[model samples]
Target: MENYIVIIAIISSIILFLSAVIVFVRFYRERTQFKILLGVALIVLLAGSIINVFEHTAILQSAEEFEQILSILFLPIIIFAIYESIIGEQLRTHIKSEQMFKGIFNQTFSFVGLLNSEGRILEANSTACDFIGYDNDEYKGVFFPETRWWKHSAEEMKNLEGAIKQAGQGKTVRYETTNIDKDGKIHYVDFSLKPIHDSRDRLIYLIAEGRDITEIKSTRLELEKHKKNLEDIVEKRTLELKTANEELQLKNETLYEKNTIINEQNAKLVSTLIDLKETQTQLLQAEKMASLGVLTAGVAHEINNPLNYIVGAYEALKQKDTHSGDEEAEMLLDAIKTGVDRVAGIVKSLNQFSRDTPAENEECNIHEIIDDSLVMLHSRLNNKIEIHKNYFKDSFVTFGNVGNFHQVFLNILSNAEQAINEKGKIWIKTTKNDNYLIITITDSGKGIEKDAINKITDPFYTTKDPGEGIGLGLSIVFGIIKEHGGRLEFESEVNKGTTVTVMLPQKGMKHE
Candidate 1:
């Protein structure tokens, strides 16, 4: 029996020590007052368990009493923390709802009041209380017509009573009436009374809403006075126009006869202009082609010289079969030659691609293309960014080189993915504005600084690492947009996000 008690005491101390360590670690991270109190209580319990393992009667009894004191002090706090952790969000939501209701009820400029169906004022907003110059408590449970907001006259009060009665019967009543403020000032107000029903459709309260319309009433009266003055001026203008019309009619006949001769002469000029325009168009086309050929040749000649250098280096290495060469050197020579040849091939291919007819356009939906772009980047979006798509249902179709459009979307989405560090959001909105289709791609990522934003689309300018990008993506997108007669723009804030907006015409540009 002594051995068993010792073993049980050891097990208890182990469990209490573990619990104390966990609580201390939690307090270290959180640094909350409740955690502080809870940590102290756990330490006391752990101390009591350790003392019990020794079997010292005097110390053990004192430790147990101290443990009881700590429990009494901290149990309520630990229980409160547990409750908060479980349902804190629900409590926060309820508090927010109360704040919103109070803001709308107390902070509005319009005079608003709630009344019992018998027309007794139950509550009034601050605006109503201030407007009538009465305390909120002063107006409680008072009849609406008898309140200070209404006039002192019997007839006015009777009319207000009638409106209130009508509102109590589920009918809305509205009228322009004279209301007396606290200082015996009369003001005209557009007042409305309506009945409010409970969830069960039982009439509960009458709502009184009002707007002061004294200035509007004054403006209407002024306009009524100006009506005759405007009519007199209009009559005078009509008499003058009548005399002018008679004289103008004779002059118009003379001018019309002269215009007939001019029209015949203009027809010959217009025909001559059309022929001249066609001739000019042909000459311009010829000039454009010649300039394009010269430019392409110059670019190819300049870039292809390095290609020959690499090829010559490889050939020299190959011919020196007797010379001993390191394997790394030989392998590098071969790689350089291969890379140069690919460059030469791409240059030649570009010249050919320009000469060949552009790929045929197809009717593609803008939203569908966006969807495809998102699919291609799903791996990146899986854990990092949430996609929000806002697109209309009806197909927004346009004649497009679908491959080119696909590249454009992919480039933009990839840039967004690279820009964000970790978790963020991307918002893509598509809408047709006037005759153009507008697509906006916005991301919550580290944004381009203002100085760098203008330089982003420039050739060979980049903010990416050496192996990550060569900086030609945005420039290519700019060219693609220009070919389609569209516009591209960017809005950004540092550490917030960037929004790329592209506007393309409904009808795509003609292929060059």
Candidate 2:
């Protein structure tokens, strides 16, 4: 027994030493408190085993006793260490997983929801709650119904429900729909549905993700309206421009027609003027023939008288029984000679007056012609009509015929005098500039009417009574001025006055 005790003591000391070393190492390593506490328990069991071998005598010296002690002391400690480590690790894992889930839910805008195969709501995230206007807990077991949002028909919802159910058969569906929230606001949502399967491929849950698109839909609608409005405005402006262009084209056509009519009228007026000129020429020739007829008669009478005288004298001389000296015959021949001389002088004067010729072009002083014409018409002027002259200091000479120049002044002055009836005045002026002579005649009469002044020089165009004067005076004046390469202008106002002006190119500066 003693030998056994000593041997047990040595073995117990070795086991306790080993356990202490292990406990020390565990503390230094900063291992689990449970593991360190287990090492301490092992040390206590080894010490108890050594004491038990002595206390129980020879019977306690059996290995079974040592084994029983170790079981009693160390078994529960090992189990406790294992339980503490496993339970603590599992608790930390569960806490970390919950924190991760909260972070993911808060950060994501994606609406997440879980549903059963029958479209019943199982669980939803906060984003899903916000979209449906429900608290996350309140929607955990709600059911989805076949109903449309904002008065749309339910057929669309029914179709979406069928698609979600079909997704349960190992497929996925993505679609868009409109839904009404708890606040009665309609929202457009784009959604994707997916089915979750367990290890055995059995349908477990349906997961759906959604994105809101209401603002996008509204923007599209507004853009469409603005596009339509722009089209309408452009169409209206196009119509207006078309109408304006049509009006301008019509005005252009009317102007072209008016121009054509005016041109035709101008041609007809020119032809009529030519006919009038020919008629005036014929009338002038007729006047000349009438004068020639009278002159011819007078010449025949004068010639006959001279011949009769000479013939009678000869007959008397022939019948006489001659005396060598015939004084009576000589006296009769002298009378016959006197009659012939008289007839010849009359014939010469008639020939001079009746001669027909064109105006002879020459350098002439119009002022001198004006003076001569005034002297000729001095007796015709009435006392009531005053005459004034404004002749320039420079001489007024032009290239023209003297007879024709005289005729022009005479016609104008006579017309002026006739225009002034009672208590009126006539003004005459002559000036030279730019190698041209300007002559002006003004009459303060019951002036020419506005309608008649433009036609005042046309042949047969006169304001006088039918026979008071032939209308040839102004016409003759116009012809002479035209032949001298001059232009005539007249200005008048009714009941105020009339002015006639003539412009003639200076001598050596004449142009046709």
TM-scores of the candidates in the order shown: 0.36, 0.37
lDDT of 1: 0.76
At residue 82, give the lDDT of candidate 1. 63
Model 1 regions lying over 4 Å from their true place: 1-100, 153-156, 170-175, 194-197, 235-512
Clashes in model 2: which pairs? Answer: none
Best by TM-score: 2
| Candidate 2 lDDT by residue in tens digits, 115-192 | 887777776677767655665376556565432222353766676667777887868998877767757777887877
Deviation in angstroms for 464 in model 2?
54
* Residue pairs with backbone overlap in model 1: none
Alpha-carbon error at 326 in model 2, in Å? 99
Go through the candidates in order and give each one's C-alpha lDDT.
0.76, 0.73
Query: Cα lDDT for residue 137, model 2?
Result: 73
